[model samples]
Each structure stands twice: as C-alpha cells, then as structure tokens.
Target: MIDISASPTSTTLVVSGDLDLAERDQFPEVTARVTGLRRQLVVIDMCRVTFMDSTGAAFLISLADSSRNRGGAAVLRGADARDLFVLEVCGALELFRIDRDHRCDDVPDAVEEPSIV
Candidate 1:
C-alpha cells in the first residue's frame, strides 16, 4: 500500500509491502499526483517495504528526477542497504537524499492528511 500526505512545503509517500512488478500499475497515478503537488520536498518512507526490484527503483528515480526538475528534492527515509544498492546499481543514487537516521515514526504530523491509493 501507498499512502500520500502533503503539507505546504512537502509531500510524503508511505510505502509498504513489495514494490515490484506487481505494483507497477499503481506507479503512474501516484507519480502524477506527487509531481502535480509541486512541493519543494518529497519524502518516501520505506521502512515497511519488504522487497523492491528494479521497477521499484525506477519509480523512485522518476519521483526524484521530477522533484529535481522542479527545483525540489526527494528524501528516502529508513531505506536499507539493499534499497540503496538497487539505486546505486541503477546509477540513480545521487537523485535522492537518503536519511538513514530517520524512521517512519520520526515523520512529523505536518503531513497528517494522508490519501491512501
């Protein structure tokens, strides 16, 4: 599941379960909504993600790229080494800011109104 929340300056995506080919169908709509927000920051909470394949990495890269193009930034919270490795292998690690110290619980309520999709 993916839950999106937004504040005036940032948007957060709380991702759970596996982010692989099976979840591909949801990526487009989620991407559109997130990019359309035009927020200055995008936070992807990956603490609950069990597995992520290349497709998931591509989705993350797309989000980071879009945010960068708009002069914003994308942050990945609670991402493990495996996730980072996937991004690195894809040559897209530089696209995001990895916050290894941050966890899902540390996310502020400023992103309180989540819309599940």
Candidate 2:
C-alpha cells in the first residue's frame, strides 16, 4: 500500500509492500489522487517497499517523467539495494533523482527500513 500526503509545494508518497506488477495497478490512481493541480516536488519514500520488478521500475520512470513535465521533480528515497541493482542492470538509474547524499528541502523525514530482512 501507499500513503500519500500532499503539501502545497510537495507530496510525500510512503510506499509499503512489494512494488511488483501485481501491486502496481493502483499506481496511477494513487498518483492522480495525491497530485494537485499545482506543481509539486514528488518525494517517493521506499522505506517499506520490500520488492520491485521491471514493471515497478517502469512505473517509477513514468512517474518521474510526468512530474518533470509539470515543472516538478521526483525524488526516490531509501530504495532497496535489490531495487537499485535492478535499476543498474536496466540502465535506468539516471531516470530518477536518488536522494542519498543530498536530500531536497521538501523531503519529509523518511525512516528507512533495514535492507536485510
């Protein structure tokens, strides 16, 4: 599941559970619901996401592109190492602005889960 909190200039998406194709069906609706008419910095907190597939990667790419088109940036935080590997293998790491070293000002406090379970 994903919990979205939209502020006036930013939106925080707390992603939980597996981000596989089976669960990506709600991605569009969730984004549409959380995104307001005005531009917003989209911060995707993947602290609780356990797994991800190629479909999920594509969804994230699309989300980032869509947000950028609206003059907003998309930030992915606390992505699992496995997911990072997937992106690396797919040569899609550049698509997302990974928030590791420097975090955007609008990013909410993201308590990352343990990578090893």
Candidate 3:
C-alpha cells in the first residue's frame, strides 16, 4: 500500500508505503500526478516503505528525470539502511537525491509557503 500526500506550503510530495513490484502498477499514476503538479520541489517520503527491487529503483529514476526536465527537484526521503543497500546494488543511487537526515517529524513544520518567481 502506498500513500502520497502533498504539502501545499512546501510543494513537496510525501510518499509512504511499499514500492515493490506489487505496487509497480501504481507508479505511472503516481508519476503522472506529480508531473502535472506545478510545484518545484517534490520530496518523496519513503520511510514507510518496507521493501524495494530493481523495478522500484527504475520507477524512482524515471520520476527524478521527469522532475528535472520540468525544472523541478525530486528528492527521496527516509531511505533506511536496507533501502540504501537496494539502491546501491541496483547502481541507481546517483540518479536520486537521497535524504539521510532521518528526520521525519519536522517535515510539516519546516515547510515554507509556496512562492512565485
């Protein structure tokens, strides 16, 4: 099960859940939803994710690329040791900007209001 929530203030997408092959079907929809968003910073919360595979890694890479093409940033959060291992093994770690802070409680409070340039 995957849950995606967006912070209006920060324009960040907080995603939590298992992103293994079972949830691969939902990846396109998820990517579409984020791609349609006009936000500049997309922070994906992956803390709740229990497992991942090569397919999941690919999905993340695609999302990151799309975000970049649109002049936005896609960041991965809550990457536990196991998650990091998976990404390293898949040789896709360079494709993502992984957050190593492990600080999930401050996301809401740290969110800054959206701004226009």
For the record, the alpha-carbon RMSD of candidate 1 to the native fold, in angstroms, is: 7.6
**What are the clashing pairs of model 2?**
none
Q: Write the per-residue lDDT of candidate 1 for residues 1-117, one digit (tens) a residue.
A: 899999999999999889999999999999999998899899999877878999999999999999999999999887777877888899998888877556457534212212111
In model 3, state the lDDT of residue 80: 63
Model 3, stretches more than 4 Å misplaced?
Answer: 7-11, 104-117
Q: All models: lDDT?
A: 0.85, 0.73, 0.67
- Provide TM-scores for the models: 0.87, 0.77, 0.74
Clashing residue pairs in candidate 3 are none
lDDT score for residue 28 of model 1:
99
Clashes of 3: 0
Q: Provide the lowest-lDDT 10-residue window in model 1.
A: 108-117
lDDT (C-alpha) at residue 84 in model 1: 79
